[model samples]
Target: MLSTAFALFCFLLAADCLETHVHGDLFVPDAILRISAQNISIGGIQRYTTLVNGSVPGPELRVSEGKVVWIRVYNDMTDRNTTMHWHGLAQAASPFSDGTPLASQWPIPPQHFFDYELQIPNDTAGTYFYHSHVGFQSVSASGSLIVEDRSNPPYKYDDERTITLQELFNLTDVDVEQRITADPLLWFGENNGFLVNGKTISDYGVIDNSTATLAVIEVDPGKTYRLRFIAATALSYTSFAFESHDGLEVIEADGHYTKPLSTDLMQMGSGQRFSVLLKTKSCDELEQSGRLDYYLQVETRERSAVATNYALLRYRDTCNLPESSVHHLPTDSYPSKKPIDLPPTISGFLDYQLQPLVPNNFPTTSQVTRRIVLNVQQFEDGYYVWRDSNVSWSDASIDSRRYTTPATPYLVSLYTNQTAYLPKYDAAIANGGVDPTTQTFPAKLGEVLEIVLQNIGSISKTNVTPGLLETHPWHAHGGHYYDLGGGPGAWSSEAMEARLQGTLPVLRDTTMLFRYNEATQPDVKSGWRAWRLRVQNPGVWMIHCHWLQHMIQGMQTVWVFGDAGDILKVPRREVEGFLTFGGDVYGNGTHVPERVHFSEGG
Candidate 1:
């Protein structure tokens, strides 16, 4: 559904704009990411997952706060299209670069490239990550993005370690996608095991002992180390704890500083990040106890069954010990004895306790302009499909050929005054939720919104009983929101009123909607989480569950911020001729000759 005016405008300008790369301010690529398919061994199995630069978890990207980082991504995969999403950073300045397929921009064609200009604002420095937002590719196409505060950092530590956590599967992306979309939908089973820094020794037994090496964290005797934990899981809620360690204190979450809170274990779903300080024990104390190494245990939470993995935390002096000695540390094997008791797990209370170090700037209830409530439900005629309220959103198009290639994205439509596909505020006001056709909730320039997300059981066409309720890690695309609070049962205005009284809200891009045990809480819907935010970013942004299977089954919605006049004011060089179907109409400036385009869409 390309608007006539926009199509004509492109045709008219196509003749004269061949040589011009772009006018106005332009930022070149600071880093180049060549995405391709690679074979990597995880837990003794070779997973056919897409990788960035031939690595499973990609590379660690470090940038400074209050600066712009331009990264050019080339889709080297021969068959599929891809896009990368900056998980924790608020991409307000560069809305088109937010990287949601068919929402912010189109998927980069095979052998084509797209440039992402990310503007990191001041006072936002902590653990963050970037991942492929298309389909289930993010299971392996993710890496750590750390923003350091050079001017003034809040905490002090001797050194830092980046731990990218994920669940490794034995199946390929195509196999899982085909099974999910088949006539009788098949669920992708639980991960084989968890990974710490793209490596782990199986706790069950040695699998491919030659290739299975546990991640080792070598530290001096008595020094504090900042451990940045990034959960890049496609599914499962993962928790991490160090054996016999008592000096762990969390100092950051998402991309903001948090008040120091001590805890025995930290639990995080996919797309969540946290930084904690771990003070290592003295060598004398460890020698007296007859142990120079400890197990960094990782286990799954809120699953049908439990799966555990381990890594080694070795003292620096232990590396010099003789191979035959008792204190020698082996990085490829597990300890002889496992801990009898695991630590208690944390849930929604993690958000409640860790207050933001930055001052609270959230608007009061009286200043709020709009409020929306959405219930996450499942529908199954034969296959499972998730919906918000009554609308089920899909990324596919009508024609079979254009299944992965939809029409122009909403951002392009809004920028070019293509009103046919845009969402209307009046229509959204008339309807309780978003219009099913548009699949968007419209917001004005500076409106404050209070959104409540409730978790409900499944409903079917044949009047089947409500299905099981599970945990959903919901993540916002454009910006972070203030997490008000969450509770069991349905959402109530009374609970909202009580939680807003003299409370300082914590800011998080991703928050969990917990699931209650069906046996304990029978005949009851499980949990709900609330958030408050002001719509300042202008563009199309998606909010959905971070779990890839739920998202693939249609558990997502979009928000259209500002009107045409506001959206059209964005710079012309930023939007036009980037990765649209016209194939860089501005000529050779956007498309580098290093790679030849073989296909248009996935």
Candidate 2:
């Protein structure tokens, strides 16, 4: 039912190649991270996990646009060895501070610490945060990593609210892991209902008679407010709308600026961040009678059983409210016009499918390159007495042994002066041997090209229906980029070239939804696993799954770019290895590590 090689990687992420102590600005723990759990009731019952420093939601670490910051994380949690990755941070370009264990740096030995430094870019702004980037950032392991406006924020809100939308549960790691691992019915696409900041539906055990399922944001009706919303769900795209409000202007997404798109409903996926200027009315006008009475709401509409808020928008200028206004003067720099109407139809539009959005095609100069198939899977493993559902989070003990049901990020690390490899169809490619798909491209200087994505999963067919291709949103660090086009999985080199000549797709520095199933099928959504981008930007760029846990579990890699003059020569290890093996004598990857012993396939 499974290949031995894959199974080996799963159980043990490969023995270390080098035994070395790492030092730098990375987040290496100074001591063991202490995380405690308590089972509580809201609608029913749930367990809330909190990190050390004693906050259910961890402390917020603020950095500026241009600075070199060092993070030293000491893993204090018991049971398993761990590491932290800076999800969405530009890693490929930023190498040392990438934060990915094993791939970019060494895994922090249990009871030990590791460190590295991140050269935060000068232009970084908007709202972006960081978490364990190790696993399940959707759970309790993450917190906001905000790069504030070096100059005071232009808005004048009474208070600043950084709300992270995530799910929580009462079960232990063992409890949840045992069920999902044992039962195939509880497969890849599952949602555990719990909110770290928001309340639960069915009154789950956390809430009783007094509290509501909303995180309140108070404001005066006259002044505009800035609400930076971050959604960190494993598989949920959320929307926010207001009934008794003027309008909301979207200024940023995924921590980067975008062509200002105004809308009441702010939509985003995991790893995506959005900010809106909530233009509120004045406080005095409300003192007489109609106070700023409002509601705040979130729904798991992506899946069937959705949740609504008891206090959707309950805000007023009461004595209990915090200072909502900032001392900085508010500026009316970007005037708000009538909101853009959502498109009603695309009936006759000529569709060439989609292609990658890098300027020009590929590149004439690529110093280092690599192609990876983000293989995702759903197995038909349990056919006997095992059948479990009504899935909830696991109990504490299960946390350590837990692995994922779906396919996680298969790493493809590249170094300067190395020839990247791409695999072809039918035949799966490993480190070297022969790449069914291989290419050589050029890397230019001073340009920071954002990468576009496509699906890269195994093709699984049902007897009667089409196969499934898992789609994940492609996330970048340092900055966000415009999204052009993404091809259907069927595209090869030839057709992709033709589609590039058409009109450009929309530019989005924010997080844009990537679709695996057709739009009409709401229950099924995913993004391309196979995508490409130009490494014009300098520094390390981290590319990984938006599902933070997947990234921590090894669904991550790094890219490095240096000045054109400093660029190293291509390492022809693949050419050398392939030639050495002779044809027909198979090998795994071109850059074969010197450790493995192999010969021609007898």
- lDDT per prediction? 0.74, 0.41
- Tens-digit per-residue lDDT, 27-67, candidate 2: 23322233333344443344444353445455667777766
Off by over 4 Å in 1: 1-28, 202-207, 318-326, 335-337, 343-345, 396-406, 461-465, 500-502, 519-524, 571-574, 585-602
Point to the candidate with the largest TM-score.
1
Model 2 CA deviation exceeding 4 Å by range: 1-44, 48-52, 91-94, 114-116, 152-159, 173-213, 283-291, 310-471, 477-480, 485-513, 516-532, 537-542, 548-602
> Candidate 1 lDDT, tens digit per residue, 1-602?
23476557657766211123332135356887878987766666666889988787899999998777878888888898888899978676666578888687777777777767788888788899999988888888989999999676788899999988888877788777666665456776778788888887544445467668888878877789999999999888887788888758999888888889998877888999989999988756776656677888888888877788888777777334443332745776666766525644454657567788879697888888888887887766656677776655556432232122346777776666556767868888778657555768888888989899988877655544556677889998877899887877788879767866766787889988886543222234667889988888777888888988777777788788787766555345434564355256211335442211111101
Candidate 1 Cα lDDT to native: 0.74
TM-score of each: 0.88, 0.61
The clash count of every prediction, one per candidate, is 0, 114
Clashing pairs in 1: none
